[model samples]
Target chain A: MVGAGHAGLAMSRCLAVRGIDHVVLERGEVANSWRTERWDSLRLLTPNWQSRLPGFGYEGDDPDGFRDMTQTVAFLQRYAEVISAPVETRTTVTSIRRDDEDYLVTTDRGEWRARSVVLASGACNLANVPKVADALPDGIASVHSFDYRNPDQLPAGGVLVVGASATGTQLGYEIHKSGRPVTLAVGEHIRVPRTYRGRDLMWWMDNAGVHDERWDEMDDINRARRVPSFQLTGTDDGSTLDLNAVTDIGVALVGRFAGLVDGKAQFSGSLLNQCALSDLKMNRLLNSFDEWAAEVGADADVEPSHRLDSTRVPEKPPLTLKLAEAGIGTVLWCTGYRPDLSWLEVDVLDRKGRICHEGGVTSSPGLYLMGMQFLRRRKSALIDGAADDADDLSEHLAAYLDG
Target chain B: MSEATVNNGVNADALVAAREALTEAPQAAQFNWRASCEWKNGTHSHSTVEGFFGLGEEQKRSKTFAFDADHPEIFASEDLGATPVEYVLVGLASCLTAGVAAIAQYRDIQLKSVKATIEGDMDIQGILGIDDEVRNGFDGIKVTYEIDADAGRDDIEALVAQSQKRSAVYDIVTNPTAVTVEVK
Candidate 1:
């Protein structure tokens, strides 16, 4: 066990059940990512009912409700206690190397010689701030979504939130609602309704067998994996926050945050296209739902609303808030995240710096990965996906150890 | 930044006098206003509505405003100024904007700009008498605000909430009122 997050703890349980001895190393407390990397008002995109561990599922009062970061953290803490995972907290892994057949995992505390190693911390370790961030002037305070807590932490004045992913949209809406003039830079993303036909869309997706989709079956697995997360929000009522809703809340919509040229933020003029793309995708999904509902005899007759017209704003947003004006005091970067594999001395990284692996089994024998997006199934990277992923990885590891 | 200055687009002097009058003589605050319009052809109407500046005995002849309105093409009329439903939206937006400006001034925050987008969804089935199931009024209304001011998001949200709570039009729309019609 390498991480103490959902992936690590779940893997530990699988190993323990198989009577295999292993110690989980965590850089911080259990579910450290959930504790540190989430915003104040953050809620799981997946409903509480889907927040299931290997042996423990959600047994809370609000199973249909989405769990906020605080509730999620507490759930993980309880899960850790229930599983009794052998975890070493505050031990950061300094290096991991393959010594002949055995793996040498070194941490700040000490080193361990094991027959197999599982990199279970998963992706989303490093904030994927673009190079354009460097061009932004020092006068403006910039913080990635990972470090952002709330609007109160931001400086007064206008805000330019880069990236229209779930995090960006939510933050932009929150900040705009807080009364600051906000300009949200739109980008490519999967658009899905928060709810359809009185049921959470996740519930329907799960039932429709979307998460069980295997990579081999996908026409373009790489492209599918690269598709950004949905423009969905997790709230008590499960209200859908599309680009229209965001714009309706008074946040200025703009194209991709191309870069800061000559000390001004540059934006592309493809906002209308982005909105059209989102609208098309959302309608396709809804039409699919309609077909599914008919086939299943489900009482659902929700007509799709008009596509949110992006051409409404003609005036190209000030190409750049001249840094000299000092009007925009903060530039929030919510441009997603990537994995941090610097500690691994093993030659498993590909050209893109991504770990070279197939279905949790790396090219290097005795090395495996868990909690990776599209490792085997679409759900392979989610909390619910950990059980099966750990089971498969542990089975392979057990066989290798026996061999 | 004088306390008595009309910095927020609200006449501070007039507001102060009204507040004092309302406090001293509560009955003086009770004034009935009306909006009457004669229907032209189709859904067009020419309205010369009464303005709100006048109240009590000191008031001279009521100041009147004129505006022409027509239904949209879908509703079988030329797209004139704004439809009746649109006027409701306009009234709501203006009233809320006023409240925001007043709150901003009261808080001494500099308001640079404020714009509102008010939209109401309606099913034509009700108005067209195609179906009895549908209601006559808008099914739902959404009011979105874009405001630039030297204040925090929370401050602005609070200001908008305050405006909504204090707005008479908002109350009228939200709460049902009693109306009796009789032939004289």
Candidate 2:
């Protein structure tokens, strides 16, 4: 195991149960992603009940409630203990190269010759900050969402939070609540309510078997792999951060960030269409929930829809705000992230630089990828699906070892 | 009623008049508000709360406001306006939000918007008489405010702190109050 996150821990447990000897190496402490990448007020997007590993589930009082950063970190640490994952903390891998039929893994601690290597780092190592961030003047401080902790870290001025994903919308909401004006640059995103039909949406999705979707079943697997994150929040009372709510809180909604033109942040005019698309997806999901509820004879009294007034925002919103005049002292880029594999000098990467793998098996003989987005199933990347992915990959590894 | 433009989402002149009356004569603020209600059935009741003033003989009158309360469909009552506990949440939210508005006006800050989400956890076991240990009142209440104004975060925090300090309902919940019951 290359990294000791949830994925790595799950793989370690599965391998251990199968009577395999493996060492889970981590650059930092166990579950370093949850510890270092999460914000101060961050919470698990899924409900507590869905926080299940192979042999353990959430044993807390509030199963329906979401776990905040502290609780989630503690839970991961407990999981590492219960599973007894032999993780060598602070052992950073410097490189991975193919040597004959085996793999040579060189690390800061020492080099290890292994029959197989599992890259369980998962995504979110390198933040995908756009080049436009570099063009901003020295007066404006630019920080990625991963690096952002709170509003106090930012200078006292307006904020232009780009990328209206879960992180972007959340940061926009948090900064706005702190009495700073915010402008959210809208992007393609799936919008789902936090709760629907008197049950958490995670429960509905789980019951609906959305997680069981396989790679082959997808009409366009590549497109599905790049689907935008959901526009939902697990913070403060846990509500949806739809465009309407964001606008209601005085967050200036704009289109995709085109780039800086003459020191002015330029935006495209696609906000209304983006909002419409999100509403469409939300309506479909709500309808699915309603159908499931009716099938289960579940009685839920949700209010009828009162459509958001899009007229509150302009129809063509390709506007620009002068960086200095707009009092925008900071521009926190809540854009998405990509995995960093610069250390792995291998031929398995595709044109998009992603690891070339089917399910969890890579093209290389002794190399396997686990915990990848859409590796085999729809929920493969989530904690709830980590066990299944690990088990499947372990089956492949056992066969390879036997051969 | 005539159409009138409202400024800062508040009637500034009316607020000034009320503030001036309270500041000039503290006794003018000693008006007893009353709520009379009759139960129609289980968990269903009608109430009419009268807002009265004691500023002068002409102001010694009442403005009637009526509403209904009933349990939700999940409970055993007809779905009416809202449950009593929901009403309590509504009161706390509005009182605090109104307090924000008033304080913003006092501070001469241009109010953009104010939003609040008030949540409380209650044990139905107490109301259902299943557990004697649990209290009928809420176990605890949490209020989250998302206020946007022409002020910094510290100012807003101070504003919320001051508002809660001076809020009547907030005081009622946070402090002990004397209540006597008698058949009249």
Candidate 3:
């Protein structure tokens, strides 16, 4: 097994419970990405209750509580201790290949053979800071979502968070709270409920079969890409939590990051155009709930005090207050990152820099991928759901190990 | 330096020769399809990229079609995982060859097959950064074309030198392109 995050730990624990002996290989310290890349204030969207491995669930004062980056890093470290999972840290896997009966895994430290391998390393490997952005006037401070930890790290200036996806929106909210002037460069987004009003939306999605394999295989790449925005609360127990309310307070909303020209940062587009997209998605979700409620003979009249209207929003640049006069100082590239598979020399990856895979299996057999974001469910990327993902990949590993 | 040869620029014959050759053209071929477009979203969304080009379009746009989307543990999302830019890049690569093939049929130039590969680099940092000053779109795009034709290199170049498959995406990628954005 390669990697030691929630996916790797869950797989190892499942094996221990199943009485399967397997080896797990990690390139950095356990949960290294979570330990390193995550911003200091970062908190899991899923509560602590959901942060479980197969044989064990979190046992702490706050079952529903959410754990911040430190807590998560500590939790995974403790998990490794508890299960006595055979893990080697600071050992980067340099090459991977397959023989008839066994798979060969290589790292800077050593080469080892396993009957099967689990690529439990999550997708954080690729931190795609744009090449061109690096060439910008070095006077301005900039950072990717990965390197950003707290407000202290940013330059003392107004910030622009580009891309209105979760990262953009969430980070924009965080920085704004720091009392820094902030603007959110907006784009298309699908805003599902944190919960249907109050109840955990994942519960409905799970019970309604949102986690099924088929949901991952939906024909509408458009729809599948629209990962549901789940409840960021902890379970009934309140130890775990997400501070959505904290984020809403300080965010400055704007339109697409059209360009930066002259002394001013330029952003102009239809917020209504985008909100229309989000509004349609919201309606689709509500409609789905309504249809389900009707089928179950349940009422569907519940609605938020605030209703969304595509037309109500302004079309001009969405800056809370226009900064058209002054030169925009810094750009917080919350735009997102791309995978760096350069070290993994494999032809399986297409020209687009991706490996071809079906479910968890890569085009090359014996080489399996796990904990991929949106790999199987939208939840694959979420720590709360990575346990199930580990098990899903473990089954395949067992086949490889057993056979 | 040599008197005439070193001092002289290209002869008028060379310029005229190039233009005449471009105009010679292959036989004409026509393709007809009643297609209409509905722009419901930005860059490339809501719309499904189908038909053919490059390697080929997947019947479904599962996260699996693009390497970056599936390996989220590794790659971050650009358009919130909508893979539109991926669709656009693949479309240009595939359509250009298809453009050549249709022209081949129209011109009665026997063409065996056509395939192409394309890649584009974008400055996502500009989009994410405060200095909206950085270029947000692709910095440069390169396409390598491989064709098996009844005619040789000269024929394929003649066909591709003037093909309609060079659509908006291709034009923007090849030429100077900018989006005007101000306070208004």
Reported per model, the fraction of native interface contacts reproduced equals 0.00, 0.00, 0.00
What residue runs in model 2 are displaced by over 4 Å at the alpha carbon?
A236-238, A295-313, A316-318, B1-184
TM-score against truth, every candidate: 0.66, 0.66, 0.63
Judged by DockQ cut-offs, is candidate 3 incorrect, acceptable, medium or high? incorrect
Best by lDDT: 2
Give a tens-digit lDDT track for model 2, residues A153-184: 99999999998888998889999999889988
**Per-model root-mean-square deviation over C-alphas:** 24.9, 26.4, 19.3
On TM-score, who's better, 2 or 3?
Answer: 2
Query: How do these models rank on lDDT, best leading?
Result: 2, 1, 3
Better-scoring candidate (TM-score), 1 or 3 = 1
Q: What's the TM-score of chain A alone for every prediction?
A: 0.94, 0.94, 0.84
User: Each model's C-alpha lDDT?
Assistant: 0.79, 0.80, 0.60
Q: DockQ of each model against the real complex?
A: 0.01, 0.01, 0.02
| Candidate 3 lDDT by residue in tens digits, A1-403 | 7788888888788777667878878878888888877777767766677666766678788755568888988888888888898998888888877766667778899898876666777676666665545544546666788788788778776777776665766677667777777766665565555556344555455555555443346653334634434323332432211223323464456665554444345454334345555555565565666666667754544443233333234323433223333334567886666555565654577645666566667766667776765666666666666677667676776676666
lDDT of 2 at A332: 91
lDDT of 1 by residue, A1-403 (tens): 6789998888988888888889999999999999988889988888888967888889878888888888888888888899898899999999999898888999999999988888988689899888867777777888899889999999888898888878888999999998788888886666777877677888777877778888779865765777787777888877877666787878887777765766777665445445555555666676666676667866444444333233244344443356437478888998999978899999998766889777889888889899888887898888888888888888998998889
Model 3 spans > 4 angstroms off: A17-19, A99-101, A213-217, A220-251, A261-264, A268-270, A293-312, A318-327, B1-184
Candidate 3 residue lDDT tens string, B104-134: 6544566555677888777777776855766
